[model samples]
Target: MNKRSLIYSGTLIFLFMVAFLIFTEQKKESPSGVVNISVQEAKGMVEKGDVFVLDVRTPDEFNSSHIKGATLIPVSNASGSNLSSNRLLEARIDEVPKKKILVYCRSGRRSVSASTMLVNAGYSEVYNMAGGINAWIDAGYPVVSSEDKETDGSQN
Candidate 1:
């Protein structure tokens, strides 16, 4: 390749690397104030009335089963890699009193996004369940299903 062309290509590669580094660095701080906790701890906190549970999974998943008393703030298109925005969480954030919010998903993938959103929204005590409901179930915790919950009651 010509000298000028080689230099231009080198510059482009350097710039791309710089941008990639910046993006990754920022991503590390993505959780910022959000905390991660074990499912067992979450259960204790919830039972002790120090934290409120939030289910960020889809409605279908929630309908099947979820932590007893967890508030449903569904987030569409949530996954481990992509933390999409949840209109429900944004619109009803005010309803979730300023307390330790324990967020979980089907298997903990979406909780990362939900917790991040809560922390970014200015909720100081936000937490993500490391393994979501799967961990909770594995810990021998009981979950509430749609058939068991009352119309307005959050728990069975």
Candidate 2:
């Protein structure tokens, strides 16, 4: 190969490597365009009342206790297949408004997948609580049980 051709190839290779590194570094912040937030941050946003809190847990778990005002949208069933989960979310997408959304589960793991599903569905500004409701409760945040809601409704 000629010296000039070798130099040109080397420069292209260097540029490609730089671009790859930059892309990967940004991906580390959030996978599939979903952001991850700490439990404390999630609490602040919830209190501010500008964000929609999504509980991606089972109905039983959600009824047991969950962040006040959170909307229940179970992401999986006993089978827990990705295809079924995606389809379920797609079917119920209308229930979720197109706004800032904070998603959580029992231990934060499931929420990541749920958040990704939301992002894939074109719902922007999605965040997954890093520690889930467990971390939120551990941080001394209060959760409202179904009984609490029932009692409140009974008085009205």
Candidate 3:
């Protein structure tokens, strides 16, 4: 083979190998059963009862405003010594099952961390909300404040 032809073939081979490696790595890291969904998608899931929405933000932040029906289990509260036993978590997340858990926080950061914790706890289906309540509110979804007064004069 000519020198120029040999060099061209080697370059093509290297490019093909790099492309293959990139594809394989992407497939491996891509979610299997777990899905990272948008705020609207998550809201639809919540409405359909297809997943459990978990607000991983602090209690104070959660109480101020959160997705309706979301269960609050702060990431900080669920880490380390707190997660050693099911007692505390059970009280907060009484109905959380080993099925699908959709987690979120102020942004995507805390939710990502909390999703790992849920998986470690043996929850099979874990979904991380790409953007948390901030995104939800930004999308014009309704939120219940901690001190919203109803016609009954009861705080919701």
Candidate 4:
């Protein structure tokens, strides 16, 4: 082939190789241990029984409103920057048997990070709530606010 043709062919080959590597890497990352579920799926899991629900929002936000059976771990508090070692979270995890855990926050971002942490911390099944509590309310699920606490008698 001519020099110009050879150069074009080499560039095309390089581009193809780059695309292949990108696709391969994506496929490898697709099987990440963290499971992401939509608001509907999370609600279904709660109804199914045997799923551990963790709310990873701040104490004030959590107290305002939260999932009925979820345990508040608060990702900010657990990272060793806010709270002191998350004894409450550790205790809850210890008390509850190993099961599928569904984690959420004000938005989905923190839940994703919290899910990774839980998986690393030895929880076999960890799921991040895709849209968080906002989606839960949008889905028409019941959220108990702090004012309801006195009447409900339910502890976090």
Per-candidate count of clashing residue pairs (backbone under 3 Å): 0, 0, 0, 0
Query: What is residue 89's positional error in candidate 4, in angstroms?
Result: 5.5
Winning model by lDDT = 2
Candidate 1 per-residue lDDT over residues 1-156, each given as its tens digit: 999999999999999999999875552233377777788778888889877889988666677788888888875554342434644677667777787788898777778877877787888888888888888877778887867652322221
Q: Which residue pairs overlap in candidate 2's backbone?
A: none
Against the true structure, candidate 2 reaches a TM-score of 0.71
lDDT of 4 by residue, 17-114 (tens): 99999875551111547877778878889999879888878776778788887777766663344565654454345644478888898768888877
* Residue range 1-156, candidate 3, lDDT tens digits: 999999999999999999999875552222433456788878888889877778777666767787777777776653243443343343445357677788888778878776766666677778888877778778877777655421221222
Backbone clash pairs for candidate 4 read none
In angstroms, what RMSD does candidate 2 have relative to the true structure? 9.2
| Model 2 lDDT-worst window of ten | 147-156
Top-TM-score structure, candidate number: 2
lDDT of 3 at 127: 82
> TM-score per candidate, in order?
0.67, 0.71, 0.62, 0.65
The lDDT values for all models are 0.75, 0.80, 0.69, 0.73
